[model samples]
Target: MKKSIVIFGSTGNLTYKKLLPAIDNLIRQKRLKKDDRVYLLARHDISLKQYIEDAKKQVKEMLDWTVLEEVLEFVYFHLNQIEDYQKLNHRLKDSGYTDNVFYLALPPKLFPEVAKGISASGLVTKGDASKRIVFEKPFGENLESARTINRELWRYFDESQIYRIDHYLGKEMIQNILVVRFANRIFGQTWNHNTIRNIVIIAKETEGVMSRGNYYDKIGALKDMLQSHLLQMAALIGMTRPKTFQSEDIKDAKVKVLNDLKLDSSSVVFGQYNGYLDENKIADDSQTETFIFAKAHFMNDKWRGTPIYFITGKKLDEKRSEIIINFKDDTNLNQIFSNAKPNNTKLVFKVAPEDGVKFQLNVKQPGLSDEIISGHLDYCHTCNWVGNTTEAYEKLLFDVLNNNKTLFTRWDEIEVMWEIISEIQHMNIPLHVYDDFDHLKEIILTEKGVDIDAL
Candidate 1:
């Protein structure tokens, strides 16, 4: 997160729905200083009063009245008109600003322009206390576009100054995979090829595009989710120890996670959902894929040959997200009490609709019978229990204020992400057909206790 936040595309859906609200919540929790300035940078041509009222209404709807005053005070907007940007500059100077963060929350096409313009303004000095940039998803349409965004960011800022916001990594449980693994000696010792078998990271949403049909077509599931969000989760699950707690160090390990991936057609599966091509808003001839599932590998000593399965889609089944790790096959597999096993265990980190971690372990049934079974040692995070469980947006904004980059993404991560996903798209691997996707969809729906046909 960049300090003294300047958010581009502040008038967009993400800012109104996620960013500003999170900031308001954090302020209510007293997690931020009153002095931190959050400047909205958009071409909306709105007044300070107009933006303030819009943001205030957003805060009111997203939070209680307790959060409104401080939130409204800190949030100021820059219209980004030539004169407005200049006028905003004077306002910053008179206000005695120390740090600045430029958040590019717009579409991919606007990235280079915004970066170039911001740099030309001379506001992004390398010697500042903390100058960062926050950008949303679809960093690029593909490998070339990904490189383009990286190049643009490079022109204006160094690797450290760019904080790519992959909101998935900011989720509490997703972040805790490392914590659960490394903190507990028992789990950490067993987290390797010797014990773990298959790891599946699936981000599924039931509705197709909702209203972003055209945008969805341009960048399908492969680019939208797997390239950034799902892969980030895979990196967290498979990475070895890092040297430091810094974003650079952690991202250094993530790059290896990508380099280790099997970047070819074989030993992988890629699928696309096209059921909506003939539906209400989408084009009848469009080949836009709403669903994607792929198998990947890390050719490293620890996780060599371990299958990393990834699935993401917009309109599929229910709206659910999770990471499941399955251990290797067992011999003398008991059929009577099939759920039970000697060494098999599973750990699931739930990221959305709620935040929590649940693990599966085998044990004898709580009866006189000599049968074993599987059960969960569950830690579920219910929002009802919280005074301050910051949303991903709030946490990112706070990181910007505090100049913390640990929770944000780095460029190398983006590069590696594009390289891996682009391989699958370019090669046109022997993909699983519609039926296979439906089968997987059924499996996913089974998890939610819903029959696919019923919907």
Candidate 2:
């Protein structure tokens, strides 16, 4: 039987920009059975038809033109009071279908409240098929907040029913981390145990936080990106071989890394930007951070001594996101070392702005000279290759509809991700303000705990 999906935060970016378009595509491809029902929950009062019209228009504007729907027949929109228990129960029961999924695309603050309200209204128990809720990044400010949010969500749904959305897992490149490591014979052979020198995962954004000043302040680079995106990438790269590729096995390995993380790292560093403060409409006293750099060490037998460098920030030079794997360079004994050329084979996973992977090896530069040189051969992700691969929202929404919890993070992972980040945040490493041009040099010159230069 087709499940009924009710998307919370229907007017939010996830819904308008991603989920609605995905559903439109799914419907166009006949993936969403005619029997399925999609409902949009928002605070504003709008008719079902109006909501569909708005969605179709937004899809056309923000995304591809092919996604525009002439008429959205399956979607319904309604104003949500949330506190009105009886009204919510009655309205949901009106669906006459039990296979239900509730997607919470709203802000993190609203996650627990929405869940509790739904529970109070008995919408969770009323579902005959399944009861699930999905949410996005920064599950909480810290471990304490994460636990609290979990508690709030549990009141409405069990751990099994809650789906915490981590887009990093859904990214083509982030997921490829596993495929590249395990599938390739050459890399896998030397992936660990004295063959690798270091792993640097950098997430750089060209633009500053446009309108999310308040949101960005409370959750800076560490909690916003590192605790979620970068760490997930690191976990995949640093984890011991899993027994299987099963979702449980994959997640189990990820959870172990976070749990086993060491807090006492003189290697870690954090930072905040200065110029962007003028962009924020909020007060000057706002302590929201925009830049963060830190090194996490895994003292395991295989990965021991291999540095895991993490760099992420806003209002930066380039809009590139990648993982640079610097292999052990031992050409110093040769003339190549005298030429100041390092044999660093970087396995770059380009995440945003472009999604693809390329291995930069020391290949023959070609042409006249026999001198060794380096270049890259990229395996570009053509537009058509993923023409139908659903957006993050669509995949997640489908998971919610199918009652799948594989993509969701376990509370244990949440607690641990926060545990590691909380210690770094508590230390309050001195911040170094810098301009975009000389930022790199400035960081390199800073003292330990006080230096951005260490990066």
Candidate-wise lDDT, in order: 0.70, 0.70
* Ten contiguous residues minimizing lDDT sum, candidate 1: 446-455
Candidate 2 lDDT tens digits, 360-413? 777665789666677787877556595555556666666667767767788888
Can you list the residue pairs that collide in candidate 1? none
TM-score of 1: 0.85
* TM-score attained by model 2: 0.87
Off by over 4 Å in 1: 1-3, 33-35, 48-60, 64-83, 263-275, 278-284, 329-344, 382-386, 428-455
lDDT of 2 at 316: 83
List TM-scores for all candidates, in order.
Answer: 0.85, 0.87
Worst 10 residues of 2 by lDDT: 70-79
